[model samples]
Target: MAKIKVLILDNDTTSRDILNKSLEESKDIEVVGIAFNEKIALDKMRLLNPDAVIFGNNFNDLSASLFTKKLLEAYPGKGVIIITDSNSKNQASDTIEALGHGAFDVVLRPDPNISDIEKIKFIERNLSSKIRCFSIKKFSRMARLLTPIEETQPYNGNFKPSCVKKYENSKFEIVLIGVSTGGPEVLTNLIPEIPKNFPIPILIVMHMPKIFTKPMSDSINRVSKIKFKEAEDNEVLKTGTGYLAPGGIHLIIRRNLKGELYVLFEDTPPVNSCKPAVDVLFKSAVGIVREKAISVVLTGMGSDGTEGVRALKENNVPCIVQDKESSVVWGMPGSVAEAGLADEILPLNMIAKRLTDLVMK
Candidate 1:
């Protein structure tokens, strides 16, 4: 297998060295080049053709969002990870903005409290993992494009295309969404298409850090007709409103004494290695709304929503997953589709319309 070539983009010499050393420890990565400015970064990008780029938070001339946008336009498929400070709220907001501008992922610089060795380990654990996942997705896509149409057939095991099910009789009261990896770009495109008077509430659990969730919700709210914000504990769910689970915690839906729908937060250990696991939210709706709810699994890196979708399917709820061609990383939705639990496998552009049709009709 070819190593994932990487280019470091940072103005700070010390920061660049740290990033270089951290990635050097990974056998699967090769540091192809380093750039101290935007011009140099672009030059190296054209020259080296690295598989991914690690962009540090030291640029003075351009904002993260603009830089990410330009970089992506220049090189479409290459993964870009923005490094930000964990203690800086401004950087967190900027990171979310970058994601909205088509950045692949974000990683925070280690907290000051941790030791030097821990900082290196932190970068290795987080940054390296994202790059590796991106590499797998990149190569799989390349393989598909390179294969001849006549020679192409669905694999026997986990890669079989899902049989699409039409839910003509489906009536839904609430929407439950789980996404990761390439969620922000998809949500930014999907949410605003929903009209203001649309019925039913939406609960979203996107894999993100705690600080970024508020900014992410705020970013989406600016363009969305519906009210979008972080979920508040004990607040009643309302129509034309979307509530995103606060990161680093579980958001569970429950009924009040009067049988009204409300949300609650759980500090339980991370399920499927995610604090705000989709399975937790999906399972919570089982006894509360039973089959009245609809679950949508968007693009994400892991199979966090498979069990949740399974539980929902058993209760006769309709499950929709983004098709592999539209997903940035198809792990989560692919897992559900491979398990034969998805009721509808739709493209990104069509998901919002399908939901509106299923619920409004």
Candidate 2:
């Protein structure tokens, strides 16, 4: 296996050294270059062509957002992770903004007051793991694109190409979506496209930290014509209102004695290494709605939704997967596509229209 070449960008000498030493400790990672400013970073990127770049908290002269955007524009396939202070007053907003600007991921730096040994351990464990994950995803994407279409099955045996014609008898009751990694940005683009009068409750399971999910919900809601907020335990599900699965807990659907559907937040242990996992939400939806459910798997980094999608398919529920061309990472949706489970595979822009057509028609 080839080592993941990395470039460290940080104006702070201590931070640069910490990231360099920690990342170098990994057997599969090699530090190719270091840059203390945007100009130097650009130069290093051209010269080294590293697999990933780690950006520290402070940029020498450029705004973090601008720098990130410019870097991504210049190096489209290269992975970028921004390190921020965990204790910062603006951590949530900053992290969200960075993600919106196209940074691959964000890592919170260890508390500055910690012992040097502990700080090194923290950097190694957190930063190195993120770098490896990013690099693996980068390589996986390249591999998928390079492989011939004939070698890869583009359409599944169970694939339903047109939901409008195929599910004439199916009454869509709910929209259940599963996303991760690049979810927020995709949601930002998708949620607003869903019109206010669209009549179906939408439940989303996005893998995010406890502090970040609420802000993400707020951010989406601000731009969307349809309202969205974090799911509250026992809240009755309603149409035209999207519910985001709260972080640190799984969001499932259940019925009260009156047979009315409501959101149930579970404290159950993480499934597929993700709390509020798509599987949990999709399974819950399947139990209640069965064939009436409309399951959509969006861009994400893992196969968290594959099993749940399988269960939905078993019940004759319609499933939609985001097309690979429009996905930031196709792992979740691709798994369903590979399993021959999706009813329709559409690009991101077409998904909202299809959802509305399926529910309203």
Candidate 3:
């Protein structure tokens, strides 16, 4: 893979320096330029033409949302990742607004009080991965648009959904969706499409900050027919409602003596470097839901859901993966596809329809 050229925009000297040095350590990324403000960043953007822009927590003139909008308008397809202050009271809401304005992803900046080593470690673990993943997607889009084709199809001649075996039992008790990277934007579009009378309860695991889940769920619920909210501990699973795993916690499924399924929360360390990991949620349902569950792997970075999906497949559960042409970052769903675990590989626009077909049948 080619190195991802990155431009850094930060007014804080110390913070900017740390970001530059930490990112420089990554072999997958190259620091093309560094700007102390958005103006200089814009000037360098034309010259450097970096694959992605990193927006620092402190800015002199524009908010992340405004800057992101400007960047996208000036250079469409350039990925923008915002760095938000962890100490800010409005961190969650601000990140959501930034994403809404077209930012690809957001990461919490380490506290200023933390040691320089700690800050470096934080950036290495969080920000670098986002940049690398975003670059893969950016390049993929460029290749698709630049390469001319006779025709476009979901899959090539040798690829066949019919060749894959799926659980024959038609019964489905619940639906599990695992998404990341572009999850927030995708979920807003998807959840509203499900009708109010949808019979099975849906459990969603989205990679996000702990503070963001409640607001995200609330925002989706406002326009969605099915009730959407952050999951509560030991809450009985209910049909016609969708449950989202709270940020920074694992959502587990357990069956009670009455054979009723409910959600449980755990503060366990992150699996696959993600709290509220898709793998954690999917694996939890292996025995509890068995063949009675249908799982969907949507747009995300990394292979978080592949292992869990394998566990689900072993138990005869059906899995649906979002196709590469429709995913924002195809790491998660792409992994499932490569592993031959997906029963169906459909575009984003078609996922809700297929889901309804499977559940409504």
Candidate 4:
């Protein structure tokens, strides 16, 4: 029942005042403080401990990444929402970069439309809706072509915990997946297979519009025994739970005050052509889990995961890609596979089976 306090961070005075007025007027959100630059932002952050910080990414000058990076080091708990007037392309690219720098969400603030639609209804629907109300849809779709990783391999993948040869180990602590187009269907199929008692946490970055992700996560939780929730800034990654990054925001992994890894959501623009991008999460896990990490890039429509997958591969972490046949759009996964970054390329149907096999081994 408590109001969520928000702090506004922007260099523009008019922008700050407008956001202050808008958030202060809302019953759900309380405007705590406003800052115009990094120095002022940090000062306000120390004194006000707001629940969320609304920062802007669009710049007539330099981007907001470095400032965000410094701000996080000092004030790590405030939920970060990065606002930008970027198109889908630049949004995705910057999203990847911000997550790597430890940002949480890449949010697209509405640009001045020559035509206003009464109010900012679109963003309100996407960013403000309750996500835990929907029914989870069953996994219905299948890929149209080849299936090798599913057929040829048992789940005991090339994973070793104490040694480099075992790229995947049985003692998996977390399941971090980066997905794009057609990801929901793939997840619906894959998540139900993760036992309710599964001992690791699962995190997904399914690139989508912010409005739909909450409902999508809510729907997913309905079918799976695992508790599912849309990620919040600094929320823990407990086992037997699944988290979906809110669309339009980038999700990153961070250690909490308890020293446990938790989620950080950002509202900055997209990185690598998409917010909730694979590149961001994959690259983060490289450091978080090192050899213990398992990065999977499923079907999507862009080359977003290519660089992130490469980072995982270089770290000797096992990187899996949903093969071309199983993917609705192959841009995301295909680039990783073509770059020789994937340790296993599996079909849609057997990805769960193989994962089970690997984790159980």
TM-score of each: 0.88, 0.81, 0.86, 0.57
The local lDDT score (0 to 100) that residue 361 gets in candidate 4 is 60
Off by over 4 Å in 1: 60-62, 138-167
RMSD of each: 5.4, 5.3, 4.2, 17.9
How big is the RMSD of model 3?
4.2
State the local distance difference test value for candidate 2.
0.80
Assess candidate 4 and give its lDDT.
Answer: 0.66
- Model 2, 99-138: lDDT tens digits are 7766777777888888767888888987887777776566
Q: Which ranges in model 2 have alpha carbons more than 4 Å from their true place?
A: 1-3, 11-14, 35-51, 58-63, 73-78, 85-89, 110-159, 162-166, 257-259
Question: Cα lDDT of all candidates, in order?
Answer: 0.84, 0.80, 0.83, 0.66
Question: Which numbered prediction scores highest in lDDT against the true structure?
Answer: 1
* Residue lDDT tens for model 3, 161-248: 6633344337789999999988877787778878899998999999988878887888789879999988999999999899999988
Highest TM-score among the candidates is held by which one? 1
* Residue lDDT tens for model 4, 118-235: 2244444433321100101111123232233445555454432234347434477677788865565567667776767776788888887765566567667887878988888878
Better of 1 and 2 by lDDT: 1
TM-score of 3: 0.86
Candidate 2 — which pairs collide?
none
Worst 10 residues of 2 by lDDT: 139-148
Candidate 3 clashes: the total is 0
Worst lDDT run of 10 residues, candidate 1, spans: 154-163
What are the per-model numbers of colliding residue pairs? 0, 0, 0, 38
